[model samples]
Target: MTKTARLYKIERLIRQRQHVSFAGLLAELEVSPATLKRDLEYLRDQLGAPITYDRELNAYRFEATGGGSALARSTARHELPGLWFSERELYALLMAHQLISGLDSQGLLSRHLQPLLDRIHELLGPGGENDSKALMKRVKIIGALRRPVDATCFERVGEALIRRQRIAMRYLTRTRGEVSQREVSPQRLVHYKNTWYLDAWCHQRERLLRFALDAVQEATLTDTRAKDVAMRQVQAEMDTGYGIYAGGTRQLAVLRFSAQAAPWTSHEEWHPEQQGRWLADGSWELTLPYADETELVMDILRQGEQVQVMAPDSLRAAVRRRLAAAAALYVGA
Candidate 1:
């Protein structure tokens, strides 16, 4: 801790306790009695205070001079709020400060938060510069979204989520090759594989759906609100799958992994309900219960020759049919 930080903590302790003994201040500030006395003298002499030790109180008491109250004088010298930050919080604060500072230089910091940033700078003590730089080097947070969403849309969605309001959105569906408008009760925003998605209850289809934020061309708030029962249902449905997409029913998905992929595959958590067993032939048997096949198929295809679908004949047939079609394309070429 730096001198300024120690002084700030001392000031906070004094204010909170009204009067603090030299021994208590020494323990809290972790400073020698001579140092604490010097600090007190400095506060009294330089800062214009009548801070003196009282035998009856057995602590230092701030006397009110004719000019102003002792509390007011000490506060005027340093008004920064003394907050105890955990390591995780410190890292988060450092990251946030870096982001805002970068955005400020680029003329993009939010107007509402600029004043708050200035106040933060005042609270940061002498060693804060070096501490912040070291923290920035050690910590990092990455956004998963491919492209940044429009700030305005992002703000609106956040507001909608807070208010629990339904939204009518104009969205482009790449899979269906269609642009359609639908009224959906916004449930939650999810991030997966660097993309942002909005999970909502579709009024038209009477089902829960997840739509990519980028795919949304336009959004308008609706007067119709989501019922508690519907929201719970959507939550329950989404919780059943690995990602946002969930099928109507759950199925047992079995996969066989080659020896080469077994070690890597065993270490990962494919799903919450995933279970794996080592086979005698140096292969691995893995089972995951999923509500959707779309995401599962993608997972299997990514493994290529290292993994094979074993059970739920439908999934195997789908994988084989897709692979055969892909192979036929290569043969024709």
Candidate 2:
């Protein structure tokens, strides 16, 4: 039998018996002891199956904790189809997994992603586990907000966004020190840097507004329903600002990057319409249309001297004003 066929048979035998000795596995697969041992090792490491030896039972058994064999089987079946994913879809899935894993670790989300992980492994094939581990080790999600977040508030906002429900929230505004209540139709939940924000249409204001989820002191779902806004329209509005608050009409913004930061900046997809032009001086120009400035400010600030806003006097003025305020902290020095 082919190695792949033999491997599958070995897996089936283990599933049927719960545990099987090396000799038994060899007999089942009609393979030699040495070949069976090699197969077991491959299954353990390559396939990420938690196979362990039981001295008392005199056999190899699946780990009682987090047995992933069933997940693996489901994953294999899904990948058999000729379904193709675009690069963006793949990246989005990866990011989603990373976020879910983080939430799971914190007890905010249930550990229900075993099947998804198994599918990822199957899609990745033999080298999937290694590649995933390596990629996760290097990539990290960081929130730009300086304050600590309330996990409950974050989860609530996400739930509301998913359910397509309007929410009544007590929000702490930056300009207003006191908490204000508003009924909002949540359009999207966005994570930028380390902070989470909800883009919603305020029923009171009759306009779109972005609320920092962490700043939400209370959020109660409302029974009153509204027309579901298209994600594209919401995104188009948001691209107008730096963060989530898209207060004005959409405008095109241009940014010139210093040579040192151009390479790293080019690797990111900042927005759907983002386009980059490499300059002769080794610098780069990135142009994209945006409707908001809140998230954009944080992004530009993160780049420091490696980037400069080239167009839209309003955005430049916003950046300059923020820099001046930051400089105030050093007045004593």
Candidate 3:
């Protein structure tokens, strides 16, 4: 039998009996004692099944706290990895992996998780020349307007985030074209549109601020511990507005889309609390909150004549100014 099939059976047997003797597993699997031992090890060590030998009970059983490493213990709440994954489920996992791998443009995450990915590949195609690898090879994921990030700098930021440590960084604020040295307590790391943003409590600013990792030229972990903030305050400060730039006092921007753009824009979600409705003329009207106009303005400009800012004079003016500037570039062209 294939190793994948045998592994599935071992998980099933242990779960069904709650405990099973080594002799019984050997008999049921019809494998040699050494092979059975190897299988048990693979299940516990590789797959993190949390199955341990209860010497007193004289059988192998699931323990609430069984693991071979810190990584294993972290995932103890999950069932055995890929033991019961159907072909369709395995395909979903592959698709998700591809999406996430694209976000990690530096390939740091993919390298660390390659072993599990390889196991999934093997389960899908034991011969190493199968449809799974071929399909992945055929697909191309393009992240539009992506900025390259320094891998070493990003690693330092991630390490501080996971270790809950404060970091000192030299940041270049593109808007002002100035560099500043700041100490920040890393709170949350956000990945959006192929970029990494760290939402942290800026020690210098005495408030929450999100820093683009690419803009960060230098990051060094500090001995100070990260100041813990409640999730509620974090969301309130960072997630209440539209798009990636969500913060500050939110003002609703009402937009009307032309009939030509309604078909596409109607299905789009601008924010969590967005409201939209189709008009009698086949136009679409959408209302969403925004704290910053940087990203929001870019999206609105994309719609061109198909969209109009209907409320909040400030946003309307911002769009108009951007449009005027764009038109100026094309004058006499």
Q: Please give each candidate's TM-score.
A: 0.72, 0.58, 0.78
Model 2 agreement with the true structure over 170-271: per-residue lDDT tens digits: 988877687888899888776555556788898888877778776889888778774488878886666545444565677878999999988888887777
Q: What is the TM-score (0 to 1) of candidate 3?
A: 0.78
Worst 10 residues of 2 by lDDT: 74-83
**Each prediction's Cα lDDT score?**
0.71, 0.70, 0.82
Best by lDDT: 3
Q: How far is candidate 3 from the true structure (C-alpha RMSD, Å)?
A: 7.0
Runs in model 1 with CA error above 4 Å? 1-12, 15-17, 20-82, 86-88, 92-124, 138-148, 223-231
List, in order, the clash count of every candidate structure. Answer: 1, 23, 0
lDDT of prediction 1 = 0.71
lDDT of 1 by residue, 6-84 (tens): 6656667766777788899999988888978877775566545456676877987555434576566433333334244
Winner by TM-score between candidate 3 and candidate 2: 3
